[model samples]
Target: MRSPCCDNRGNNNKGAWSKEEDQKLIDYIRAHGRVCWRSLPKAAGLLRCGKSCRLRWINYLRPDVKRGRFEEDEEDLIIKLHALLGNRWSLIAGRLPGRTDNEVKNYWNSHLRKKLASMGIDPDNHRVIHNARLHRSHSSSNATRSSIDKSTNGLQNNSENGFRDDDDLNLDLTISLPSSQRTGSDHLQNTASRTLLLFP
Candidate 1:
């Protein structure tokens, strides 16, 4: 891997931090409990920038960090948080104790995204749009009333009254029904209910 950008040869003697360097940093931190990052390099005998030292300490050498694969619960929590926060991996990771944002992001891209896509959901929006005829089978009050009126007019006008001219019938058939009758309405309702559950 590339060396950290903060590493400089001219500083406290650049290059990768060895075990001795790590120990020196740890000892200094233990003794001083963290000084200013800009001043830390000189005090700790590190050639790295303040930012680099801080990143190393927080991401790698932190005493509290738990290193390993995430648990099932952690993965589930990450997914739930990601759906709400989108690409804010740090925010998602915040809900997962002992997990890092980088780790969560990688898992999302590699595993969860694929799983969602395979299930016909848009990984980006977490919604599925299938072109089924049931989705087209909606009904509207005006439409239902019109159909009832047309049928009544046809019955009253004559045997042909219940039936309209082929062209007229075809035109009426093009009207969209209400979305509640659509095949996906149940799914949409479920999603809405889940959202309500989350908040309330």
Candidate 2:
């Protein structure tokens, strides 16, 4: 029977990696440098899928991977970062060297989530445990408020398409007629008359 982790190549094992398999993968990666995981199964003689092998390397077997329990500083930093970044664990992980996003996410869900609750904080909102309030805004910025109101009300002049495509509204042009065309009225005007053209 083949394991889910089995690759196209026949040299690999399936399920959890054995000590022998781990050593083989480690040795191959160290010697050739980590590149082209599809070929890794044949190169390292691993029976596991490329994705599984890659994940194992990144999350567990990386040389710089930190071990043991999370420290107080690490916990505090994770909490502070979680408060700012939310569930984007990868970004948060980047800030904390030697910690993977998966590790941080797991630690947050398993440990810090309970800790926050015990401290009367909402893990989701990161807010102090309190009844929700109707947050009414009594903004003093009347200038901005009035401008918004004006814009809303002024829509009457605009088309249903939400565009102020009215030609009259934009026509502020005054044109002067030529002397030849200006001659009119009682007889002939001595001066050229300026005409204001309004589309409306």
Candidate 3:
């Protein structure tokens, strides 16, 4: 009767590692520097599979690991990198110091994707907001031109009735104001205002 490779007897009586098991694995890896996973459990006196020990050490016990909450800048970088790299979590994690691919993947799935979606930005394509902005600008320009044309047509029609009034000019001014002004929050206020006036 042959036993399974992962059986308790084959694993040297180890299953899920305890805190003590984790400490033993860490200490062994630190002293020995990952010579071989096949030989690690025997060398470290751990009752666990070499593969399990390696995973625990690399994923959880590595000294360079950053275990706390992801910072704001880290979150932003993750979003940008994810946009560029998609689910190539290892590549994204490589750009982020002390963060693991598993950690980054979890954070993206749990937080960053939702945040981008909430901002009306596509997590998969970062250019969604830019495209929307350009579309809105084009539509706004068309609307303003349409309004001006309508006002001009009204004025031409009314020339037969009477002279143009101050109220008519005021209406034109109001209709034209937004076309010459920016539409966004204070963070973009100066840039938008400058662009609107300059471009107009």
lDDT values for all models: 0.55, 0.62, 0.58
| lDDT value, candidate 3, whole model | 0.58
Q: In model 1, what are the clashing residue pairs, if there are any?
A: 138-177, 139-177, 139-178, 154-161, 154-162
Residue runs of model 3 more than 4 Å from their true location after superposition: 1-16, 127-200
Collision count of model 2: 3
Compute the lDDT of residue 111 as modeled in candidate 1: 82
What does candidate 3 score in Cα RMSD to the true structure?
A: 20.2
Worst 10 residues of 1 by lDDT: 167-176
What's the lDDT of the predicted structure labeled candidate 2? 0.62
**Residue 67 alpha-carbon offset, candidate 3, angstroms:** 1.7
Cα-based TM-score, every candidate: 0.54, 0.58, 0.55
| lDDT, residue 16, model 3 | 71
Q: Is 1 or 3 the stronger prediction by TM-score?
A: 3
Ranking by lDDT: 2, 3, 1
What's model 2's TM-score? 0.58
- Tens digit of lDDT per residue, candidate 1, span 21-138? 7887788899899889878977888666787778678666768667887665565555555544568776566556565677778888998776555544456654443542222233
Off by over 4 Å in 1: 1-17, 129-200
